[model samples]
Target chain A: MSIKFKHVSYVYAPATPFEQKGLDDVSFELKENQFIALIGHTGSGKSTLMQHFNALLQPSSGEIALAGHRITPTTKQRDLKTLRQQVSLVFQFPEAQLFESTVLADIAFGPKNFGYTDAEAKKLALKWLEKVGLPKSIANKSPFELSGGQMRRVAIAGVMAYEPAILCLDEPAAGLDPKGRHMMLELFKAYQARGHTVILVTHNMDDVADYADDVLVMEHGRLLRHTTPSEVFKDRAWLLKHGLGQPAASEFAAQLAENGLPLLPQPLTLTALTHRLVAHFKGGE
Target chain B: MTKIIIGRYIPGSALIYKFDARGKLLVTFLFVFAIFLANNWPTYLVATLYTGLAIMGTGLRAHVFWDGVKPMVLLILFTSALQLFFSTGGTVYFHWWGLWLTSTGIVNAIFIFLRFTLIILISTVMTVTTQPLAISDAMEWLLTPLKWVGVPVAQLALVMSIALRFVPTLFDETLKIMNAQKARGADFNSGGLIKRSKAIAPLIIPLFISSLEIAVDLATAMEARGYQGTSGRTRYRVLSWQKYDLLNAGAFVVLLILLKVLG
Candidate 1:
């Protein structure tokens, strides 16, 4: 197993008036190279669960085994250093974490921290900068001077430069325009295509339908469901009751079926929905 | 993390919470002054009991008070220990290797500890009972006289309030940066003093940059909302003195006079 959480739970500010249950008896397993989408409403403990993957947070109860490291409440901080190098998390608004003087230096910061030499780090930074679609000429400028989208790209490149075996992102495409969002999602998909695990926490069901292979649904700090996107989105009424929206294609397919225009199966993606409609029209002809 | 009670206002319906922020601020100042004025054991005991009563009156939990005192435990102990060994007076209770533990030393240490505890407890009670905005408003009102002398009192108060408000926000930002760096294999623990300080550079730089960005954003937002830097602003929540505020102030003066007479 690449990642396994066995009855894990977490509480924030335990034993105080502000104490809150952030995660409740969550248990799941994720295999290697799987593109997993973690979906939940705000404050549903999605971020808290993702932080456990890299040992940024330890489970308050039970245990988690990620890439062979068994993490419990008593895990030593020193043991997490290697785990962090293997599982990198790109937090929300990660661009704000850029602090190096130049864009190149900022991108190289991660690789260098992970033991890459100056020249090697810079080389990797240059490679990833281009891969993230930024020009080499802007590498020497301050990241703060860049536009919002460019800064996000630079920040993402910084994490990608280190190239962890498992990548976890929290709302990576949030606040981006459609094009930027598409580019970001495509970049992550490409990363997963290279045989690496990608765990994405996002609210966009369309992105889930198009990209994610497996889906983990969270509700009120509990793991309500863990299945494929097709399976999870198929239960439209259940998803709606849980305050989750279905993919547009699936909802439209459901409406069409309700109107007596039957599709063979629910189409989750635009291409699948289009193919189904074309076949229906040909059959009518 | 829960132990961080400073700058956090706990809501309550106690008399202390009901008193005006201005009256509370003045009383806090006077209380701190009264603490320093207590040089004898009797006076320190009275101050400690009074501060304890004041803390209980605020309706804050006992542990919250202990949380504030917890960090200062070591300092208090160290100071008391120094006084216990070095202070020379009264009958010697025990004689050790070139050191005498005397009655006066014991009394002095206890007096010092009680004084420190009382002062810290008073301040903690004030901060916990009064909201930060109320404190800032009180500060602005108290500093209004400085405007005649050309001090930007309103601006200063605004800056103070903003800074106070961002304390928790910046704390969270620091945690986020630290987590980001840690994910990159930066170890904050397990290092020498210099190494750890160097590791902190990653956290501090991001924090400073992000704080500047947040400041710029806040300024833009304020201007967008037509904040004229106190020149043309009208009060939304105006502060008015109540009868309890006068009673509270009167009670503090009475306590001060009583302490003087008894001590």
Candidate 2:
């Protein structure tokens, strides 16, 4: 599902002594099937913006729309529930959200919430568990007994069972080792291949460069930039000014470019950089 | 999500920080007692002026104090209404639906409202000036004499302090869990009472499970750090009675005597 924000602003503890403005006039749009990466520092409204995608939070003053549904304060409550089903969010430290005793029941919660029969929900849960590379035998085991990575997979599978049109992940790779990160990326790639839109909110630049088609940078509860990954990385000076930097491969390429080498073509990954170097050497003949 | 404002103490390093927690608690209790013992308009005026001065000296924001006292406004109004309709002394003013209104009823209503308002204001002042940790520490110290009864006051206070410290952390965790459940089409705010409660069940289960995990981790960390409870433990920062505390205690005794004479 495509998501759009129109001049949204949210203030916490409004009309109270401890009131704080969490988001300030944030306006951006993500088109259908766009793998958008959202990056921000702590309390920068990135999580707040993610909530708006599914109408989990209504903008205090402005507007949000998912696909064709306008999410406003006056939006019908029933409509909001339907919108949530269409747009699923997997939160940071997802393992902490697992509650059902068995991995199977935890993954089936979403489908059950959406009115799936018990059998249908369990079937959907098993399908997603397999999709996340978990064997069906582990389905009957308690979620709390699983390793951290397995628990995270079960939590993600829980959301995936809903077959949402759009999926938003908040720091999905946090606390994961390199191998776990690779597996998560592969899972997202597979999800994307199935034509579902993906929105990843993260602090890691490497993931953004490797997976995101477009990027949105946030600082201090305000949107700083929204553009294609290549374009965002090209403005290296601006990124640095905001305490953000290019992906490591792009930084290496930039150093080469600084020394009068025209070899790096806005490289986003090490493999791409290596291929460019090989092509340059071959072209030297 | 925000509860009673009066119960929340805005952390600061003002002059009130110097007073021992036990001294402050005793003084505040006496002050509240004095306010309640006030008799006629003259006594009420004296108590009101004293409380106003104490509030000003505490350096609390007047607006915040008023906000904390706002919830009591309804109770005050209801009490005023009861007194206005039920009192039977002084010159008769009006009558309606078998209810008689007299000048005394109006005066009594005003008096009761003012009296309760003063009590509430003084209590708010005390709480707003003292942090929860200090309050608990004071409680533990005062209840120290109760150790003869074999009470685990220190343990109780530690549990309370830890719980208070984790309030914000748990609040954040709950918000995260709510968002996660909401994302999965768990309609929390939009259903029948039973359905809404059912939706919340999932949220609570996850929150409780996570809290259990956190508790385990915290216990492990505490044991690893050699925590053996308050017994035989020396505090890095200890509360010692200062000149101000002594002076404050003396003032409290004087206030109690004065209140008794006026009553």
Candidate 3:
């Protein structure tokens, strides 16, 4: 089922001195198969919202309709195993979650948990292992033996092996090098293209500009804005006020406008910026 | 956060908090010893009153102490139940199916329960009022005499401080690992003993690896900072007697005397 959140609110340590409002009246609906970027400053409830995808963190108030399952504050964890299997979450620094003796076994863990047969789980694990660009020979090696990047790939692959309908990630490429980050984002983009919904929580505006079809902006645990990435950066003043950065291209376009070449439509991506510059110069000729 | 309240330090500036950590630790130790002197009803009542006064002096809500004691409640009940079932002496009040509840056992159980609870509450009071770092520092200062016996007191204090520091870090990691595994459908609850242990495998392995990595990183960081066995190191926080410490120690002595006389 398509996902929808209705007035969802979560409070940590409710009714106590240490109580904190994790999410405040967050309401939104997401279309299927779209790459959604969940953007916010730290402590803006992005991770809290991400946890609600699979009912990992139940809302204190509202109902979440996620992949045909109705999850409320009263939802039993036992009933959400299928929901979790259908909608997976890869937490930040997922490599820290790796535990199995071998890379392939770790990758196969999710599928096996989701009720796939042993053979089927092995097949899925192998497919994802290759898909994540790890060498086939390392399948038997302990995950701890792999390099940090490889370990990250294995941890990510383990979650993706089950082929969840919706995949939510919290800074999945946070500490990776540039090339590794690009490759990891490409994997998620490809997954989204293949009819799976992807929700990515990231601080990188460039990645949002490059990949996201929808952007969900959060502030003080509220969904302040839910729009396209272009729209998110369109209001530079708003972005600046909220301490958000524009994509490199958008920032460059803004600079170009200040330098007297005012393009009618601001470009949000590098290719669009190049095309805009080329057209602006050619039009002048 | 996992909300493991034992030895949790809540930020407060009550009378107990104003007292020196060393004084608090010593008083807590003396209190534990005094609680054992609580044999009969009068002594237990005096012990309870002393503990209640200490709890009130902390200026923390009663529930905070309750939260600390809540987890051990089952164990406490079980221990008390064992005392009820065994120890055949005095009047046999009840007998059923190889179980005996004698008057002596009943009194013994009540005393044991009071001792356990009073000790726990007093320890919790000291812990909640005093910082972990302060506790470690006070421990080092209190064990100063052991330096003459060739004990590595400073190094021991450093290790204790580091271990105490990692409690919250490791607790958070445990939670993170558990949630990560749960997302992949690793059922921690609702299983047989074997099923549960199997589920815990995913959690424990990750936690152990991460903690090892953390310890290594900490060691490297400490070495890089030239932490040479605390030699030529002056205290950033020197433990000293506070104005309220004398009063606290005096009150504790009064408590012991009261318990002794009442018993």
Q: Tell me the deviation in Å of residue B146 in model 1.
A: 2.4
Q: Is candidate 1 or candidate 3 better by lDDT?
A: 3
lDDT of 3 by residue, B1-263 (tens): 32443358888877778888889888887776677787889889888988899899889999989987998899889999899898799999888988999999999889888888888998999888988889889999889999999999999998998898788789889988999999998889987998888889999999999999999999999889988787789877887787777898788888788878888
lDDT score, candidate 2, position B124: 76
Restricted to chain B, the TM-score per model reads 0.80, 0.85, 0.77
Error of 2 at A23 (Å): 1.8
Maximum-TM-score candidate: 3
Chain A only, candidate 3, TM-score:
0.98
lDDT string, candidate 2, B113-211, tens digits: 887887778777768778787788888788898887989887887887778777777888898888787778676777688887777887899889878
Candidate 3: CAPRI quality band: medium
TM-score-wise, the better of 2 and 3 is 3
lDDT of 1 by residue, A93-168 (tens): 8987788889999999989988999999999999999999899999999998899999999999999998998999
Total residue pair clashes for candidate 2: 0
What's each prediction's TM-score?
0.88, 0.86, 0.89
- TM-score of candidate 3 on Cα atoms, chains taken together: 0.89
Q: Estimate every model's Cα lDDT from 0 to 1.
A: 0.88, 0.82, 0.90
